[model samples]
Target: MKLLVLFSLFFVLCSVESLKVLVLFHMPVKSLSILGTGVVRHLLNAGHEVTYVTVYPLKNPPTKNFRQIDISKNVELVANDETLTMGYVLEHQIEKNGAYQIQVFSQENARQTFQNENLKKLIQDPNEHFDVVFSDLLESEVYSGLAVLYDCPMIWLYSMGAHWQVLRLIDHGTNPAFTPDYLSPNDLPLSLFERVEELWARIRWQFLKTFITQPEERKIYEETFGPLLAQRGRTLPDYEEVMYNASLIFANEHHAIRDRPATPQNFKYVGGFHIEDPVQPLPKHFQDLIENSKHGVIYFSMGSFLKSNSLPKKLVQELLNMFGQLKQTVIWKFETTLPDVPKNVHIVHWAPQPSILAHPNVKIFITHGGLLSSMEAIHFGVPIIGVPVFFDQFTNINKAVINGYALRVNLNYDLPKGLSAAIDVMLNDDRYSKKVKEMSAIYHDSLTKPGDEIVHWVEHVVRTRGARHLRSPAFNVPLYQRLYLDVLAIILAAVYLVKYIIASFDTKKAKKQSQKKKN
Candidate 1:
């Protein structure tokens, strides 16, 4: 019995190996950082040492194994830059040129990151080492250079659903015929014209990437990483090749929330991983309002990026007037104080969204359709009315609408009536609640919890020395071979040759016939 117990202990000790991990999530968005921190927290809990490069550090006290490198100044810079706001996005019609805007902004962000003194020192240190590097798969691929510098496996974490552009990194199959672009507001089963539009968008993006984005990124890559490679007696790899060399991609998406496209073996879905289990209790005021509401509680937030204060005054008045008439209590996350408040409306500068969503009396969520918000709503089984502002918010809302759990309203001055009607329908209808609850069940029904799955995969990569076996074979194949363009060219040449020979023979026969006649 003693020997068996010792053997069991030995096996357990052998199974769990602590790894040093480097996590880079410098998007400066709280939602994006939340996803990264989720992975960081789980890794720490599992006895791994973590060095987190973040704009938002963990609020909880740091443990011995955790090290946070503060980059909050970057966040402040972005926040203070009015040009990066939603107002500018609207005023300049930025979404029309979102690809170019994103590329330019990402390059600038990466440039600043590389210039940070702490980050620079970390890179310059010869003794610094990490078993694996996890980075946000935002528009910036230059950060992947860190993994290359460390000589470790690279993993990408997408804060939202995986789109075609990022999927191309791992050579995952993408069919625009059915799958909509991340920025596109359209849903599946597209019409003929939509398919044509989608195809054109893909092609145009490819051209832009080749001609514009790639060159810009390469310049930054060479400028930043060239010296580091020289120090290590190594040469810089191709920028595009380094970006494509990721061993795993963990996307914050699941089949229950959206259509499942064909993905590579290395692509894993871990949506709703950030939602706290056994959600914490709401503040006393919030709890009282929710419990005492006769009809139900409605939660409204535009997420962290789009501030309610930024809304046009006339539109805000309209929303306030609309909310004043609702029978249910409304908890609005408004950044500024408004005078002449409605009796049934409560304004909060900040909201504990997950806790509020978990409340039994919370009926409907009025949101901007950000992926994290959508996932939280689904996790707690609350239906939402999405007023999407830009980018993937449109796509996220469209998916919820298709899933039958949410309604979408455009953000405009005259949206109060439409929004009121949507709220009324959601409040009265039971179908929306039922569908979201069903989705919540599906979201919860996974082999292991998302956090566990993430840690397992992270350790798995480190344990297996980069898990090269899991990579898609398509990664190695050239585009011409993959698309069979070379084969098509050969077939076309053979056909042309046959046609020429047949035409020549016919001409000779005709000439011989003419000669006979002449004789």
Candidate 2:
């Protein structure tokens, strides 16, 4: 048995082969950046050459295997989009502006990045080539065209849950009965109306994508890649085929976090690949602070996209007042300092989130329930008080609550009381921490490291020359066929035909009887 195990390990180590890879992730969000960077780092460490195109570029300790095209200027525009501020998002702009606006903005960002002189030059070079293309599954399909341009397989990097929006590219869409919409806040066992609404949301999003977004994306694809393809005397690939022919999707999802029933085989869960093992040590002052705290510490942060300082002043003061009443020292990740702060409260413009979470003296985490934050909290085995602001944050927080490791408080109502209650529950009720610790054990129980899985699968796809066997046939099946609507149509037509024939025979019999009576 020992000899067999040793042979298997040797085979696995020897099977790894280095190849060229292209990474296109133009989204400016921090979580997406971290996820993309993790994949790039793993591939580069395995002796693979990479060309990374992104809005957030690598800054230090540059390696020869990696080449970067920095588009941080366009990323700045996206981050500072006037409508995307915390104030606007609080006013429900995310829902009101809808996915359509989001798609338009994403396309605009992609267009700008692809048109950059540096990226254009990369495409113009005849010597440039890659074995596979890994891209962020943002709203744009502009990057999917790269797979066709390079004549290689494509793998989508889904930075969050399995959003129904991209489900069409892999397998059929998930059943709305159990799978919640990305924009919805509803929990499972949805009410009849909520179920109908969820279905409607899918239909609505499909309509928008089909009629509105895809056309624009295709145009961008043609404009961006058409000339390049023509220069090589190749025909432009079909937009739908390019979009749907992904070899695999590496989603940042885990059953321990969200229990999904019917995700496709090609969709691999590699959620915590970005989390650090043997987490980095804290800065000296922060370490001292955590060590000196006698009553333990409550860490508060509102992830990256939303500015915690931009929250209403009234709510901030109310939260501070509530924190003042607690025995636990409060460490808040506020972007700015507050005047007349409580003696027990410590404010930092920026906090080392993972380091702080790893500290033994931290008792509970009050968070915005972003996926990265939630995963980090679980990684460190800390219970949570979730304050969900928008989008999938609501669903993530609710899942945490259902998992028994969290309590949620809405950002809109009863700020002080709700926060205090959630904090109290997390700190006093030992059950929350205990449950989270159990989950943390399950989270780390994978047979191989998530990073190794990523590199192995990426190599597998290249070794098999596209790993086409892993893809689902559902991508080729039309929506009508997948829903069995065509079968339903035939059955309904047969029933109507039978009823018509029977009614005709009955009419003839009645006519004959009347004729005999008259004679």
Q: Highest lDDT: which candidate?
A: 1
**What's the TM-score of every candidate structure?**
0.94, 0.92
Compared with the true structure, what per-residue lDDT tens digits does model 1 show for residues 1-519?
999999999999998888999999887788888887788878888899999998887788466898888777677547677765555554554433466777677777777888888788888898999999998877778888988899999999987776888788887558999888887877888999999988988987788778987787888889888998998899999998898888899999886866867788888988888887777889998888899999999999999878778667777888899999999899999889998789999999988999999999999999999999998998899999998877788889999999999999876655798899999899889999999999999988878988889999998998888788988888789989998999999999999999999999999999999999999
Tens digit per residue, CA lDDT, model 2, 1-519:
999999999999787667999988788776688887888888888889999887778777346788887777676656656555566565553532366777777888887878788888887886888999999987777798888888899999987788777776888878898888776888887999989988988888888888988898899899888888998889998888788888988888775775665677788888878876667789998999998999999999888777876667887898888899998889998888799789999999888899999998899999988888988888889999998877678888888998999999877637689888788777778999999999988888888878889998999999898888887887778879878999999999999999999999999999999999999
Candidate 2: deviation at residue 305, Å? 1.9
The stretch of ten residues in a row with the least summed lDDT in candidate 1 is 88-97
What is the C-alpha local distance difference test score of each model?
A: 0.86, 0.83
Candidate 1: segments with Cα more than 4 A from true spot: 1-7, 83-97, 507-519
RMSD of 2: 3.6
The total of clashing pairs for model 2 equals: 0
Off by over 4 Å in 2: 1-16, 90-97, 500-519
